[model samples]
Target: MDFLNKLKDITTFVFDVDGVLTDGSVFVSEETGEQTRAFNIKDGYALQLAVKLGYNVCAISGSRSKSAIHRLNSLGITEVFIGARDKTEKFKVYLEERHLKATNVLYMGDDIPDLGVIQMAGLPVCPADAAEEIKAVCEYVSPIPGGRGCARDVIEKVLKVQGKWMNAEAYSW
Candidate 1:
C-alpha cells in the first residue's frame, strides 16, 4: 500500500514519551531530585488538535517521570502510560480495550524498548535521532529530531491526508 493510504486508515496515534516526545534529555534538579522533560509547543498543538478531532492519542514511556506524564496530560492525552515495563503488552491492552486493529494505528517510537510495539503498528515511524535498530524497522523516519517538531511532522501529515488538518477547528487551538 502507498503511504497516503496508510495515513488514511490511522485512527489512533501512539507515541513513546522520552525520545519521541522530548529530546531524550532529562534535567534532574540536584536540590529536589526531580526529573523534567521538555516538549515542543508545535507538537502539543498537533496532539490537542488530534484529540479535538476525535482521534485516539496515547503516550507510552518506560520513564516514570511525573513531569513528563503531567505534560502529556496537559495536552489532553489521557491514554498516557508512564513506567511501561513491557510496552508490547501495554500496546496490546490498549488495542483490546479500544477494540482497535493494529492496522489502523500509527505507532512512533525511538528506541529498543519500543521495537515490539512499533512493529505491530500499521505505520511505524521514528525521529531522525532514533536508534539505528529502530530506524531500520520504521516505515517512516521524521527528518526532525525528537523534541523538535517530529511529532508535529507526522501528525500534520496524517491529518492533512485525512482532510482534518487546518480546518475551522485548527484555527482556534
Candidate 2:
C-alpha cells in the first residue's frame, strides 16, 4: 500500500510507551527513587504536528510510570492509558467514549501487547526495531528505530499523505 493513502483512513493516533516512546530501557535508582527514560525529540515534534493537524493523540501502555505521564503532559497530550493489559479492550472503550469508529484510528506498537490494537485499527504502524512478527503485520514500518524518531517519521508520512503537513505549525518548535 502507498504510505500516503493510509493516512486517509486515520483520525486518531495511538502509541505504545515502552519501546515506542522510550528506548525499551528502565532506569531505576533504588537510593534516590528516581527513574529516567530517554525520549526522541523528533517523535515529540511529530506528535505536536499531529495535534496541530487536528488529530486526536493517545498513548497506551501496560506499564504505569509517572515518568510517562510527565513526559506526555509536557507535550500537551491528555489521552493516556497506563497499566492496560488488554489494549484492544481499552481501545474499544476509547473509541466508544470518543464516538469514533475502528477504521478511523492509526495504532503504532512494537511488542506483543500491541498486537491486538494494531490488528483492530485502520492503519497499523511499527518502528524499525519492531519484532519480526509485528513488522510482518504492520501497514507501515518506519526507517528510524523506536524512541529515536520513528514515531515522528510515521506522523510525517501520515500528514504528508493527508495533505496536512504544510498546515501543521505546531511542529515549528
Candidate 3:
C-alpha cells in the first residue's frame, strides 16, 4: 500500500476526461452551437510530467470533443479514444496493440463509465472529488480535487514511489 511500491508497477496511464481532467461540467452554448469544457492546468502539467518521465499516457472517454483532442495533441498525447461506450473492451484492444500487459497499466477515473477500466488496471486512482463508489474501489485517491491538480498529485506520487521523481528534468540542474 506504500505509494512508491505502486509506482514501481505502473508502465502506462489511462485517463477519463470529464471528471478526471475537467471539472465534470459540460457547457453547451446554444448561441454558437458549441460545447465547452474546462481543464485544470495543474493536472495537465502532471500529465506532461508523466510523459517526461517516459510513461505512456492515453485518454479514454465516452464523450467526443474536438477541443479535447486539440488539447491532448498539444500536450503530445497521441493515444486517445473518444466516444467509447465500452471502455474495458477498448482498453483490452489498446493493450494488445501496444503489447502491454494489464498489470503494467494505471488508470484514473471519477465515474461509473470508468469503472470497468479502473478495475482492470494494475493501479487504479481516483481524485478526491470522485464518486463514492469509485473512491471505494480505487487503489489510491489523490489528495487534490479534479481540475485542481489531482492528476499532478497522482503523477508525483507515482514518480516518487518509483524513484523517478528526482530524476525528472525540473528537479535537475
Instruction: Give the local distance difference test score of model 2.
Output: 0.85
Q: Estimate each model's TM-score.
A: 0.98, 0.92, 0.91
lDDT for model 3, on a 0 to 1 scale?
0.83
Error of 2 at 108 (Å): 0.5
For all candidates in order, the CA lDDT equals: 0.93, 0.85, 0.83
Model 1 scores worst on lDDT over the 10 consecutive residues at: 67-76
Tens digit per residue, CA lDDT, model 2, 1-173: 45566687788899999999887998988999787778888888888778766799999999888788888877778898998989999999999999998787888999888999989988899899999989999988888788998888877777777777866385375
lDDT of 1 by residue, 1-173 (tens): 97788999999999999888899999989999988988899999999999999999998899898987788888888999989999999999999999999999999999999999988999999999999999999999999999999999999999999999989999866
In terms of lDDT, the poorest run of 10 residues in model 3 is 164-173
In candidate 2, how many Å is residue 47 off?
Answer: 0.8
lDDT for each residue of candidate 3 in 1-173, tens digit (9 for 90 to 100): 55457688888988888888887888988898787788887677777777777789999989987678888777768887889999999999999998998888889899988889988898899999999999999988988777777777877777777777767464521
List the candidates ranked by TM-score, beginning with the highest. 1, 2, 3
* Regions of candidate 2 where Cα sits further than 4 Å from its true position: 1-3, 168-171
The residue-level lDDT of candidate 1 at 126 comes to 97
Better of 1 and 3 by TM-score: 1
Order of candidates by lDDT, top first?
1, 2, 3
Residue 134 displacement in candidate 1 (angstroms): 0.8
Off by over 4 Å in 3: 1-3, 166-168, 171-173
